[model samples]
Target: EAGVTQSPTHLIKTRGQQVTLRCSPISGHTSVYWYQQALGLGLQFLLWYDEGEERNRGNFPPRFSGRQFPNYSSELNVNALELEDSALYLCASVPTGYSNQPQHFGDGTRLSIL
Candidate 1:
């Protein structure tokens, strides 16, 4: 199967700016997750979307939001961007019925705050 794909592989922004990153899940996958990977810190879960609904989210601020499309693709939006938000934003997807299976990740979007 093909892997998940992310667009705009790299982004540069300044504090207070807003950005939107997109993700396309692998064919047949219905759940998508957004994560942040900064230096030193490992991957931190951000948001979860399933079947076009926002199901759950991590301990992030309200500035972070996302939604799943009917076709299963997803998007992650960051508002009031901060320097601390500069990191590799990753998107992963898993088949809805097989929670035990490992999620497949995209190459990730590197967001740099100026």
Candidate 2:
């Protein structure tokens, strides 16, 4: 049973630069979701992909988007990043056809915009 993993546990970037974060879902999972958690803030859903297609997305701007690979891994892409974008980007994966199943999250990729 492979658990989720994120790259570059911490990320630092200047304002206006783009960043891409990676995530690998646990084995046997089929849904991957991306979230943004600012300092002292709650989780904000960015995108959701299940069965290799976009399933749902939050009210984020177009710049916030992502996709799930055939292997169930996923990536989040934020373009024209802003200082406000500085936050811990977390990814969660759920089981197939189990929307209510508790989502398993990775440690998250911390993105810092100067």
Candidate 3:
């Protein structure tokens, strides 16, 4: 069984530039989630999408958004990026409709703001 995978291992951007992170969940998974891990701060949940619909979102602003595709993959988009947004964006997924299922995380995309 393959685990989650993220693309563009690294990204460099300026303070107002937008960035999009992609993720492919393990086969057969239908629930996808996004998270942000800053240098000093630990992981923080960003968004949650299941079966192609957004189920929940973290405390982040509207600029932090994402969507799930028909194939169960997901894309996280951060607009008007700020220096504080520099961090590793991680994507995780789990089998849908199972409350006890554990989420599997992706390698993460490191976004650096200049």
Residue-wise C-alpha lDDT for candidate 1, range 1-114, written one tens digit per residue:
789999889999999999999999999999998999999999999998888888789999999998888999998999999999999999999989345679899999999999
lDDT of 3 at 69: 95
- For model 3, residues 20-85, the per-residue Cα lDDT tens digits are 899999999999989899988899989989999998898999998888899999999999999999
Native-to-model Cα distance after best TM-score fit, residue 71 in candidate 3, in Å: 0.5
Give the runs in model 3 whose Cα sits over 4 Å from its true position: 97-100
1 against 2, candidate with superior lDDT = 1
Candidate 1, residue 38: how far the Cα is off, in Å: 0.6
| lDDT comparing candidate 3 with the true structure | 0.91
Model 1 clash count equals 0
Q: Alpha carbon lDDT of residue 47, candidate 2?
A: 89
Best candidate according to lDDT:
1
Clashing pairs in 3: none
- For each candidate, what is the lDDT? 0.93, 0.90, 0.91
Estimate the overall C-alpha local distance difference test score of candidate 2.
Answer: 0.90
Clashing pairs in 1: none
